[model samples]
Target: MMVRRSGRYTTWRGFKDFALGKPPDEEKEKPKPEDDLSNHDEIFLKSIVESPDFGRKSEPIESEEDLVVKPVSLDNVNIIRSLSEYRGNNIRTIEQAELAILLSRIHFKALIDAHDAIGALWLQRGSGIEEPPKQDKDTAEGAETSPEENGDMPVETVKVVGLRKVPGQPLGLTVTTDEHGQLIVARILAGSAAAKQALLSIGDVLLEVDGVQVDTEEQLKEAVSKPNDRVTLKVGPNLKEKSSQLTNKLSCYMRALFDYNPKEDTLLPCKEIGLEFKKGDILQVSDRKDPNWWQASHVENPDVVGLIPSPELEERRKAYVPPEADFVHKISICGARISKKKKKFVYESRSSVQLEGAELALYEEVARTPPFLRRVLALVGTRGVGRRTLKNRMLHEHPRRFGAVVPHTSRPPRPLEENGTSYWFVSREEMERDAHAGRFLEYGEHNGHLYGTHLDSIRAVIKEGKMCILDCAPASLKLLHNSSEFLPYVVLLAAPGIEQLRNLTFASNRNLTEEDMKQTLEESARIQRQNEKYIDLVITNHNNDTSYSRIMDALHALSTDHQWVPVSWIY
Candidate 1:
């Protein structure tokens, strides 16, 4: 039978004979291009079954021998030294293993050092930057023209102002944004590296560093940390700011009443430039033209100028704080809370000047005044805090030094009582009218007799050259303490802890229960939260004598010390 093979039909009898391993026909053996039957190029046909296992059925091998004839180990692989047996005499395993890595690192560091040294040598021989094109005489003269000579319009300067960074020292300069929203060098910390830069000023406006525009501290820091640690800054003068600084000849100082970290203030125009202040931090307010943000710096370091929120801005942020509930409804006399029925507090007068200074300004303008005693010594605290006792002691022990404002009364004069001595005796109709006119500070009826402290009576004590000592309610502080008149130095007689109050032996609060002590703490906390800004000093009235002595010391210091009173008290 003929079958197709090698793209041509050929006889299949020889192929069937080759596969059967039955000896080949031997008649002829066709050779392909790859097969050579003989060196003479002639066919020498042989039996196809001559090879070993040629006819046996194909099957898997059950057993095998190793194929790798030349297997090697660490000992044999290294001819110089047997690596498997090598170990240090004293070095630990970790150190021995890392020796090569350490040497490699050393080599790398040496290479880097060599590179830097070579580069420095080459840098010394390198060409310098090309000189800038010279400006014409007219252009140079125009540059020298003053801003004022140019019709109040500031002449733009095309130059840079900066300080060099000393090696191994910080820049010691803080950044802030100006009113124009430009980044500026705000504060130069005391004893900092930059403070040595005499030419650099606090308000100098920054435009760019290392030719890269930087608007934030982060950006500036990134720009400054170039290949070379030294950086160049492009600065423009804040002409308007300079004018404002010149206009404000007097150093306007203020006492910060709140802790303000600019970083935490989300509303601050630029947090990086905002001045941080703690409670009672004396600050010199440099600029107040912006009603929201005032440029100020710590009095301790007035060289650093930074923005702080204005009083109006901070007050608006706090929103409307209604009158204190306790101060409004209840009445505390001599650091003791009395019942509403007993006190008979006038509801209409709750909104009076009692709350005038209650919500104290965040920053109070303060100035050091000549040695002078406070106009009024107003004491405040909850009931059973020994306020009345302290006031009475001050008056009793030092009669000439401390005096009380003899209140007015609508009741008829008693047999022995003299006018302006026991009480200011006034007709009932006239007293009612004066009380209605807000002349009476704490007016209310007591057993059908109208009795209350009058503004005029407090003034009378002041006119007598005596500190008018009054244990008035915390609410009355607003009406009594002010910038114009009645600059009362308020003191708070605070309640002790429950444990301290419970173990008190000197205080005569035998009637107070556990709940009463807790109530006192809560009330004291409320008053402190509401009127702490108004208070000048606080004395915990755990021991009456100790507190009394402390109060005496405070009163003595007030007169002798140069008081930092509200600047409004002066100009």
Candidate 2:
């Protein structure tokens, strides 16, 4: 039913028209404005737009709406028409004058708009308001308006800015009087009331707060303390100069190793704005300009900035130095007080050399990462707890998923013992040599045989794609906790109440005394206090079966829930 034609020339012409656009003759005709722009006026507007001093960019005029043409006043049009009729050639002589006329009109319109926005606030709305007498002008023409120091220096222009008070939030700034006796902003905390308003900046001079002249820092503080919902601040801001007090943002986070109560800190310049956080709370350390104090906010709420003690400040104040004999590893123990007891900590690394670290797990740098199964789950406990029973049950119940790092021993194999199954059999000489080389995490010469937990043994289980269940004493906990190579999730198996512990079969089988059980609880408390930051979880050994199930649930969570780890582990 359809007729086909070659029509190759017609198709080619159509394609050419699309690429090159319609010819001028065939293009749509747009109706011109009834009163068109004069050549001089058009050139004047274009010159103003193109001028760099005007700070405007030239854009293509696509339509009448885009151009936003405002017709000249009828009176001006009549004057121009009359001038053209009298001296047609004269119109070109003063064409440059149009730009001046256009600029004046724009300036006048801007003034009206600004007055409409803020002029009403200038009125004295309440009683007891007295206007200060005006002073003679001294600033040079086009001088910047900013906060001015009170004495000696030539006066600079001051701008009065209004700020609304936010309830239950600190003013988010600290003030101090300069040597010139003028109140100046010492710090402007990020995300605080002043920061959000953006009208105040660090180093701004405070002239008045809520209509009260603030010549000193005390006056500024008192004025800000008023219960008014809206407060007016007269400050001199220097937009041209940058203040060194402005904090630079750092992409870092710190986990609080110890509880901090700001009210107790005597050195805080402004105690009310000090940051308070409990142990293990992660903080986003936004600013670290000062070595003694840092600007930080909780990770859960980063909008409010507060001051917290710096790592250097806390390190010097809270550090507990141990004796040389027990300083086997001099690494920083975050949140833990160093115990001087030789048996509680390693005497030295296996290499016979002390580990080189001044690390006090004091504010430990942390990073959030994707869900990952930890390589090791190290169990630490007192003697009376069913810690060993719980760990063995996990291995027996899920051998494919859980594993144990076989401890190395130099003793001869007993009747039923096997080489690798029972223990990694080794010669005493080799054990001594390895222990001296720091190959063993914790080693000792017991009776005539050498026994120790080897770091390499733990690696073997992890290599097999199983989470190694490491049963080690408290002495080895520090080494494993800090080692990125092991990434152990340390859990402290605590003993239950003495009465509850006495009801256990294990306690009865050994004929443990009440005082012995009481001593175990005391030792458990001491261990927890020393390594509070390093411990990920604590489960009381009320029932062996219950503790086993609790540990299994936690192990499963390690693979499904996001975890926060030391930054050094990843980077």
Candidate 3:
């Protein structure tokens, strides 16, 4: 019959003392609540305590034969010894011994699982359900077979991996199953942790994740989806051949079509690869193989390399148009009104406006034309006289022979403008400093911002062997007439007589009032009468198409016909 205790039994204490090789101490018995054990626990304890040679010293098992009849107590002793040896220490007291026993249980459990898995794998290998082809030593030494030659044969390899996780981010590897039912790596994202590690490669088969064997793509994905900060994986060898293809780089220059905001795009790999460009920026395209995007750098800033939308994929911003009537027209009307007010002030003061010595010298200098190596075509006109429209037409007609001088402005760039392309965007201080240093040929203030034509900017176009064209203020002509190197062939674009002006339609959104038309006529008449000596040719703009043809004819005559030039250019 089995002995039963009525009061509480210290089975755990007894076991702990036994494992630690400590003698049990005798004391007075104390009554406590009885804790019952389940059938499994009772059986386990009985197997451990009632076994023969439970506490006997024994030799270490050296052969397989010795392990066949090993007792349960001996096996427990071996497990404890193994754990202690692994930890580089020995179990000393009851508490330490108990903790060591628990840890040893867990360690053995994991070891048993790993051993079972390895055993199953070996069994499958021996069973010959599927086998790899064997190569003869002599034949392998003579000639190695290429991967392509091994048509349908599966190559087996193994690898161990550890992947660290970032909070709420993916592993950044795309995987798919090959024809052999092996999960293979397809793509690695540009900026992911996996990409940084760079241990895995395309065409490498995935074997297991987190110790779970993965045979299919679904299994691999599910295993990787577990919630863990770090992960481990087993993978096969990479089978892809080393490529010998060369990269061909082509150089191109283009203008940015639209604005780019990198934060708005999710697919960009990193900040370095995100191409942030403003409209009208000239880009140097170095790679154009991608259908939707191209690798490029800013022309003004070559160090900035990134991906930008292809010309086919991006919509370009249209040319800028003034909110009101053309700026040239506004300038002319304002000048006329100011001159009329000044004359009225002079009459009230009972003083006649007379030219002083300095003023007479300035007028005489401007009246004399200077010699020039090349001619700058300057278009001058009153309000709504079609100066800009005619300049654009001339450019379209003669693309190779002419180029426009992009002006400098001390104003912030608009959304569709870029520095050195639409306009040379600069600060007020820089523009003022340059102006004081005589770097500008002509400078003026408009809308509370400074706008000017720099000498170097004009020469930049001239250096390209093309005639420089400008639509400028009348004051600029006076300055140009004084310089021998920059003498302009001034063309005054005049409004037609009142009858023809009434018949013509203006191409602006602002309503052309009678007062506005009247002011334009007066301004045109004043320009023709006062600047007749400086004007090379005066063309009345009645019809756009007809006027364009007449201007082209005039330009042709100027280029071919001989005219008077200053003696300085001849010398």
Candidate 4:
């Protein structure tokens, strides 16, 4: 049969015969040019097909009498004497049986030492200690004992606990296991049976439930899950230090982004701490140090305090978009035409003496429009689009008349930042609470921290009789436009073309990636298309000097020239 040898097929009967314990067929074993087997292959074949007698079989014995028994003789053996024995005839010695026992004990101790060394090495490699050291058979049999009998560790003190549960109501406590294999109370739900009792605390180790010893989390859960309205538990106080300090009281305001139902949530401890709010409802945050939850109350009703999800401010900001932007495409075609017709009608009506009731009301409203005392210059753009640089330049050029409002943030101040100069550093609870209370003119989250401009802070600048210039997110335009307190002049700071942007000397300093440039371009296009109506001016920021000059000219016009105002503001 043909066999594969090296890279070629060859009809070699020698290997087949050799494999079957037969001698090689010399004629068939002859090498051919087509058979590319190397010297190594020949040597391998010869080694595998060895002679039948290579590993010789022993011959069977004829009978049991053929075996001979031999004994070692002590007559020819020389016994060596110890040097100490020759010097002193009174040397203390142990009995033979006792000596054998001592030797066995020493051997066992050596084995245990070697085992411990191996276990230590394994632990150092992060595998963790596997099993306890094996005790000697005799010692192991009598080693079983209680903790008190060992007297090496403190004995745990167990306390009996009884909690009542209303039918179909939750027990309001969650359980988990610690490293020591103790069942611990993880969370006590508010307003539930466990929370009301005040006996169960977070980190309490559960020893028994309903008279049955419970060591595992599953056992404790099963014990508490019984149909009965009453449950009993035996627990021990946690010896470890508390993980978080309860002394700090953080305060803030927040708007609910979603609805929460305490009864439906298994993680909630009690109804008292269960916060439920509608989509737009603002909440007053009292504490936010908890890792997963925050304590807050509704802004309208401070007494209704409860626990709510501690979501980042960015999450809430993502939920907001200008209402008009949603239907920009539908209104874009007719918007300009309708605006022109209304303007023409107003202009023609102003010249006429007699007018309709609606037209007369409009005339009166426009006539009563208050003159601008101070105008807020708001710069809007995507991230890394030089809004901050432009604002800083404007302020630097006109520091006396133009001022910037210090934004408030829920993030910690950086090493170089001051409390009121760089940012108004506040806690998440405080930021959220104030935001929901309508204290902020604009707010958004970034990098897990809440950032917003408070209305009061802006008013403080206006109160000083200085115009406030802010570079803010596009989402804040509508809020600022509607506010009469600070008549805001919205300007879209469009990003220059990618080529122009890259050529700028300051572009490299911004550390902008390809994706960032692409996003900025996309966002610029979105603002122009969707929010064109809200934009009073557009500056394609190709050159810093040119853009600054244009901004100055626009600000000058808004301040000195006759400008249109909203009818609602006049009313």
lDDT (Cα atoms) of all candidates against the true structure:
0.63, 0.68, 0.59, 0.58
Measured on C-alpha atoms, candidate 2 has an lDDT of 0.68
lDDT of 4 by residue, 413-524 (tens): 7888889998889999998788667677667677788877887888888888788997766556666655676778887887788877665525537666677777667667
lDDT, residue 94, model 3: 79
* Superior by TM-score: candidate 1 or candidate 4: 1
In candidate 4, how many Å is residue 256 off? 36
At residue 555, candidate 1 shows an lDDT of 76
lDDT of 4 at 203: 78
Model 1 accuracy (lDDT, Cα): 0.63
Largest TM-score belongs to which candidate?
2
In the range 1-571, model 2's lDDT, one tens digit per residue, is 0111223344434433432333444677344443576445544554564577543433333443342222212123323322323322233546545633443464644644454333233333332324333333333221223224334333434655677789877788887766667677777787787776666767777776765777766677778888878777766654346446545677589888778889988878888899999888999988787678888999998876899999888877765533333322332233334455535332234432255323465678899999988888889887768777778888888999889988899998898888889699999999888887778987876677888888798889999998899777765666776678889888889878887788764544766887898777767876666666678989888887788778888988988998889887898
- In TM-score terms, candidate 4 sits at 0.36
lDDT (Cα, tens digit) per residue for candidate 1, span 1-571: 1112133212334444544334555555543542654432222222334334643632322322211112121112221112222333334678666753443454644654554454444335542423233343244211223445434434444344445666655566667776767777665544444555443556776767866778776788777655565666666566554543443325588887777889988887555567898877889876665567777788778766677888888777666434333543232211122223222343224435444433445767789887777788989888777778788888999999889988788899989888988888888999888877778667777789888888898888889988899877766766655545888888898878887777552355467788988877877765665665678888887788899888888878976888888765677
Candidate 3 per-residue lDDT, tens place, 1-571, comes to: 0112223335645765544444568754333322544345645654565466753533433544332321112123323433543332344677877766676676765655554454445445553323334343234211223344334434223445576766666676667676667777765543466655555666676766876878876777678778988787766544555343253356756544336766665544433355687644566666665555566776667745667655444422111222342223442221211223221110010011121211211001111223233568888887677788888988888988888988889989999787889799999999888877777766778889988888788788878887788887654565565567766778898888665666663463435778778877877766654444356678888888988887677767656665454334344
Query: lDDT at 331 for candidate 3?
Result: 26
Return the candidate ranking by lDDT, descending: 2, 1, 3, 4
Q: Model 2 off-target regions past 4 Å?
A: 1-157, 178-180, 237-248, 264-266, 315-361, 414-416, 505-508
Top candidate, metric lDDT:
2
- Indicate whether candidate 1 or candidate 2 has the larger lDDT: 2
